[model samples]
Target: MSAPHFYLHNLGVPLLLAVVLFCAFDLTQLDVLISNQFYDPLTHTFVLEHDRLFEKLTHKLPRILPDTTGELAVIGMLLSFAWTLLPKGRFSAWLERVRVAPALRWLTAHRRDFIFLVVSFAITTGMVHYFKSHTSVWCPVETTLYGGIHEKREWFENFSLLHEAGEGRCWPGGHASSGFTLLALYFVARRYRWRHARALFIAVMTLGMIYGSTRVPQGWHFVSHTFWSGIIVWLSMLGTALAFYGRERLSQPALDAPRHAPETAAPGLSEGLSVSGR
Candidate 1:
């Protein structure tokens, strides 16, 4: 397959999944109906109100720069073009060998990576769900700045702009978790080649940071939320990598032993004895 197609196959599903998550949060009007108490220090009055996502998008902008869909598409296009331009060499051959048509072999090569992705998604999702039901301290990132001093409110006001938003109620910084999980997977899987491994590791780390920062502008999470979420993700990935690597080492030796030597029939013994006598 062509490079662009290859990348699309690998990355499209993940991107789509993220989009679905963001859309779900935006569409359910959670941002619109959530109530918060705002204190006006000058008037010494507290106002309780519900906030909307549309309002947040229009007014309370994030501190980080916005990314348009068009811009992202263009970037993907350029990256794909660059990948296709690279010359094929020994490294390419090795990569192909590892990626050959045999599904079992490929799975064996990428099992840890696949497991990491699965586990990361499950754990993050579960945490997000569990926290959504029990949190009352106010998303710590926004306790003072967005919600004021009120403690009786069940919901926090959504800041529509990046400038006004605070932290998340549930598991904050979902992006950080997603990005760091992938990073750890790459780090573990790339042990065969140091240079390529380092490059991939750097790329994933950068992506995780970028993803974390977007929470601020998106008005969904705070900086601290992102940081803590990232820590959790990093720890999870590291633990998973160690476990997977250990299991692989213990189970691999039996498979590596040769089953049998090249066979020579009894007739071959007669041919060996007549070599010089004739």
Candidate 2:
């Protein structure tokens, strides 16, 4: 296969795995319900008592509106369509400009930057993953609060936003990472005058917050989880940028040399010839 074809083929598997993993994570609680196991907690464990903020809301509307499910279904369809179609248009253009070529070029020119970025990303992801795996508690709330409706129905979880709905629901929020990543990437990609990049970041961040927070009421997660999600994403992005692009000065040779200089003056040396003085 050609280079581009091979690149796409390699990317396709990861993208598909990501989507499947997301779906499995989001729908996990719901799957328990469908298996008639949502009530297992009530049968096997002592109920922990507390005056949660959602007590009143849950009592008022124990079951979600059917239309909510319909709306989500519609939205999902629309997003799938856009994911397939919109990329060829505006999204493609943006990616072309900020493509890995520039990132790699920066790395090739500045080894320090490359080391920093890699280390930063590693540390941030490690922290996030550690917290996600060990710290936050996962108490499928609906199983205890409204187990009747959810029991025997996987689709019921789809009605309540409080129920986790995607893969990595138990992990440091991928939605938050997505939001922060977009913002950081936009800032990196568009450092010039005011642009739609800021607006896009804001919109996505809002969506991430809303999406993350929605999982709380259904007994999906605690408010702390959502908050940490945002914090982790923002910190990870900042860390990555600082590590990769922290160096302020450019390579003096690249900046000082004339643009139209011969290929021999571009830094690389051949045999006895020196790039800077050739």
Candidate 3:
């Protein structure tokens, strides 16, 4: 496929949708819809909070899953590399014989994947924090709309009118990145065009959604913010995958075709040489 295919189809469409979705969301009351439908006015409670089931689901349960999942990912990579690097030993030899050996074998063949996962996880996740640091968009709990202190501000009201970064850093959700970074796993799995790619994508996204939900009850992120976080990470992962793997797949096959052995005239046509004699 051409370069444009990678940009326009794989990565561009998602980003365009993300921007459009975010902009269109501004026109809707879904934020308030979720707030009002689920939020209790008299008790100032979220209906889901009636039993703290949502609370535990969002606030506590993620502490066990995606939160540690990233660390485990990092540890696993480090262990794979470190153990592979160690001089032959009982433990290292044993590692090569275990269930993990297949993964380690895959890792050995996929050095680029190792770097992509370790690096892109940070890159994709960092964009969320970058927006958080620069954006004035407040969380649901930070605005007076939810019985908080600050007046609600449109996302861009401060442009040109003022210059300081607002205290609010909750625009694109941060916790969600922990889950979405696992999307890198999808890209890695997709490199082999494995059926597991779809499964990995689903698993990682579910992981992010669970983590993203945790902050909602506490008013740290609007549902849309969590949604946006997923979009950003999804787009980022796709783009990075394109960058890392695009040229290799596009060019390697053509280059792999053995060049025709130097073309030569038939023996009879070779500079008047006949087939029978030189």
**Which candidate number maximizes TM-score?**
3
lDDT of 1 at 21: 46
The sequence of per-residue lDDT tens digits that candidate 2 reaches over residues 225-267 is 4445655655565545534443231111122322321232224
Q: Write the per-residue lDDT of candidate 1 for residues 221-270, one digit (tens) a residue.
A: 54444554554555455445445443332222222222221121112212
Q: What TM-score does candidate 3 get on C-alpha atoms?
A: 0.72
- Per-candidate clashes come to 10, 6, 1
Which residue runs does candidate 2 get wrong by more than 4 Å?
1-126, 140-175, 190-194, 247-278
> Deviation in angstroms for 169 in model 2?
7.9
Worst 10 residues of 2 by lDDT: 249-258
Give residue 14's error in model 3 in angstroms. Answer: 1.5
Candidate that would win on lDDT = 3
Of models 1 and 3, which has the larger TM-score?
Answer: 3
Output the worst ten-in-a-row residue range by lDDT, candidate 1.
260-269
Candidates ranked, most accurate by lDDT first? 3, 1, 2
lDDT per residue as tens, model 3, 1-278: 66776557656777787778767766677676665655667977655544577666666676566547567667655654653465677766687777665565444444455566777877887777766666678877667887788876655563223344677777677778777887887775555445456667788888788787667766667777777888888877776776776644422212222232112112212222222222
